[model samples]
Target: MNKLLIALLVFLFFSCAKESDSVAKKRITDEVFVPTLKIDSTDLLGLPKDTGGIHKGYLLNETEAVYAHMIYTPGGYQESGEGYPLLIFLHGWGPRQLTNEIGTDLNVVKEHGPPALIEQKQWNPSFPFIVASPQLEGQYWASADVHSFIDYIIEKYNINTNRIYLTGLSLGGGGCWYYVGEKGEESHAAAIIPISARGEASIVSNLTNTPIWAFHGAKDQTVEPINNYGSVTMVNEINRNSPAVIAKVTVFDNAGHDAWTRTYGNQFGETGISYSPFNLNIYDWLLQYKKE
Candidate 1:
């Protein structure tokens, strides 16, 4: 009788532990959303279909769902032998409904960054990376959400793990800063380009090893140019070196909060310097770094 009782107690304990673990796993899997591997027209109305262009689809988990996000793949992505780099582009704040409600129009995402260029039929087909732009569901872009989506993208596509990049404008720019600052060395972005938003300078130490090229308008009152200037300056101060000082900020002296237009459009005005120190565009600058 004593032996039987002891055996029963052990069995119950083990069963409870197993059950707890199962519940925990299910909870985790359900909470975080993951995009479907097969991109489709589920929420793509005003957006272009995935005919070797921007593809729209839903990011869903077991429990919750958000509206469709846009992703752009290179022309020969399916046939490429080598893994292509991945660029995760985050957009700034849009219409109030875009974040507060479900089924918001997907076209708002293309208002800035690479997605806009794609919609305009101006994105170079030879561009060498896979781009994913996830819309903000709430007021801000959370780092955890960005991390999870990145994990999904890395797994879902033929991504070069060493060459992942991140960029954003306005509110999205702030998200970029928050993501890299919060994740530190684990952020996994080879480089980040933040435009028109000043992020927290308190997180400067976190950016020591990360290459950054921040842009802001000098005369802007919306988000002062000092925000980005101060952050980048602190980074350079923390890790002072010549060519080694990879973190830099470019303030458009005559421009306003809309510095992203020229930057993303790769259109530097007459005073805009586009060569020598760092040539071409932000895209080329991003491709210059790869994690060791």
Candidate 2:
């Protein structure tokens, strides 16, 4: 063929190819085949909600008694297989909040804490947790009750030896730290979250690698933030040399002493500093730690 004809033929072929590419791009712009990978619900690593079914119990001794409200796995307490984490919850001063007298009834504790989250607020935990909230017989937590309850539940449930978590509010917040103080490394709890509570910084020195996230309200008068949140700062100071024992405090400006109402994991909302109208999910943060 002539050179001019050959050149014309080549140009036509190139034009056709470009046109074809343009058409394909247009098709994709209109509707491309986007692929999605489906995940199985069972394969998902998560926890189920308690569905507001709280069982009541009493840890009693001759001179001591502790009322408890518990929520187990969705499969129930006995049905939960292996590797379930236990969430030990200590409710804030409930005698005055729940009832006037200690002998009144256990119904008061249910109005707040994990019991209130699941039953009243309809809060759902996004992790498979066997949560137990102890209603203090007095104004504060009794180390004896915490120690006994830990033993009791360990014996009763198929608990994850490493993933135990401790959390509480107000008086209960201090109690959580108090338990950590008593057990320290021996507690075997993976992480600790205290809302509106505190303990001596000297005692927290023992938590060399235990993770702590404390929350407090600036406006709280019931239990000042400095007490509990200050305790967290003290932990940070004490364990500054240890990478594993860093403590974080999320302080709110307008919130009151009821910081737990805002800062709990996977309840009321999906965790966060838990401002009045918002929730910053911290459940994942709590789940990040495991016993070494």
Among these predicted structures, which one has the highest TM-score? 1
lDDT (CA) per prediction: 0.68, 0.62
RMSD of 2: 10.7
Off by over 4 Å in 1: 1-54, 59-68, 95-103, 227-245, 270-279
- lDDT of residue 203 for candidate 1: 68
Candidate 1 lDDT trough over 10 residues, lowest sum: 35-44
lDDT of 1 by residue, 83-116 (tens): 6778888888772234423345556777777888
Clashing pairs in model 1, backbone N/Cα/C closer than 3 A: none
Report, for all candidates in order, the number of backbone clashes: 0, 8
Off by over 4 Å in 2: 1-73, 76-80, 96-104, 227-232, 239-243, 265-280
Model 2: lDDT of residue 21: 99
